[model samples]
Target: ATQGVEENIQEVVGHITEGVCRPLKVRIEQVIVAEPGAVLLYKISNLLKFYHHTISGIFGNSATTLLTTIEEMHLLSKKKYFFNSLSLHASKLMDKVELPPPDLGPSSALNQTLMLLREVLASHDSSVVPLDARQADFVQVLSCVLDPLLQMCTVSASNLGTADMATFMVNSLYMMKTTLALFEFTDRRLEMLQFQIEAHLDTLINEQASYVLTRTGLSYIYNTVQQHKPEQGPLANLPNLDSVALKAAMVQFDRYLSAPDNLLMPQLNFLLSATVK
Candidate 1:
């Protein structure tokens, strides 16, 4: 009879403890999912840590049920913090992103994206990531925020004319590169931006060269040579390469060489990079 009485008491104690912890677990989860910002998550995690330590001290630190609940809540909050912050920025980028203006200057999308980065970087002081993990976290934050913006810019530029598209990309990428330069631990990102800029510059240079060749009347000869095979024996056979056409082309070429600056494409004036112009 005594054994039956003891078992009943233990069952009652177990139900009471579970009842207490169940409400707490629900409340912690609500706080974790509902909280809008990472800063708040850090504060909540710190508070949980304090409570965890206090409980462990009293309960001999043997992973008591309450302590275990607190630890799980702490981890959940952290995971939610990063996920929430990234999702918020990604949604904003999709909504407000825009294309570059006519002058090849930074677009509305680039401005807003840079402002978002500034705000995120400002919050780094309050970050709760451990010292060893901070670098990795920083990289993730940049990739989550910046990579999408880059892709959006690329997509937007696709609708532009060939002459303006590469220039706009260069301008947008240049601003992004400069903004990142003001921050630390972004060497890899800088290198990637630099590489992209160089590639665009190469395209722009090729376009300009083609324009010059066509304007100076040399593209006819250039294309003929490119299309002609060695076996074709191209010297005097082609009517387009006659003496009169050659003289006119040479005159146009000489005129371009004498006043090259005056003959530049007007669109080049809108290019943002002075070094490129």
Candidate 2:
């Protein structure tokens, strides 16, 4: 029965991608290559649903077995070929076509797809099943890919002019943060990951650190920093600081730093402090 359900879901998704997404992509191509019109907003919406459902179905199974299977697959000599083929096929299907509307704006489809992919790919519960060396290595590789993308998404969200797009971007960042927190890793890797996340979020929120915070909730901190800093001499030469937010995020993260828990905070703090000096 489960197999039947999974197959049916896959069929529906295939139909949507072929019947709806393909035509929409062609229409979007015309819009991008020619004059502007209403880009296929309906198609974009349906495509999002199709991808979401497909990913969810695949991940609905046990996470531990899924992660194990992925590891086994990766260990195979042909793993690169499999990975590259999957990536290429997805790229070809999605294409780089833009929407016809000059301002339909950035679709959250990619971000959503990535989030679902991670969820489906992650182990079910690391607390119960301790990671072997091979699993640890796999985690590192996945982190390498995800970390930079998370930073880019955070920056993109901040720069998005429209309120709706900005909100979607922020939600995506939050989801990414929560997902990273769930993965089991060494203290150092976890700390580095957290720092990357907080640093980006801080840039979005800290007033003295980011001009982008001008209209954001974090602008208040920037205002406070500007008011308190000396106007000239040594203080003037020093960088603008939002000690409050920085301290808060660090303290919150410290709670997770412990033995057998991935000593990420102390190491990250050491590197960052060294760079500052």
**TM-score of every candidate:** 0.69, 0.33
lDDT of each: 0.74, 0.41
lDDT of 1 by residue, 1-277 (tens): 9999867765665455556687998987887778656556656665676677676665443336767788788777755674476657666766755766878777786787687676565555354445445566568778887888888788778888776888888888888887888776789999999999889888888888888889989898888978888888864588778888888989998998998886676567777777767
Q: In model 2, where do residues sit more than 4 Å from their true spots? A: 1-78, 85-107, 123-130, 151-155, 158-170, 186-190, 200-277
lDDT of 2 at 267: 17
Candidate 2 clashes between residue pairs 3 or more apart in a chain or in different chains: 186-262, 187-262, 187-263, 187-264, 191-264, 207-222
Write model 2 residue lDDT over 123-163, tens digit each, in one string. Answer: 22322222464355446445544554544454445544443
Q: Identify the leading candidate in terms of lDDT.
A: 1
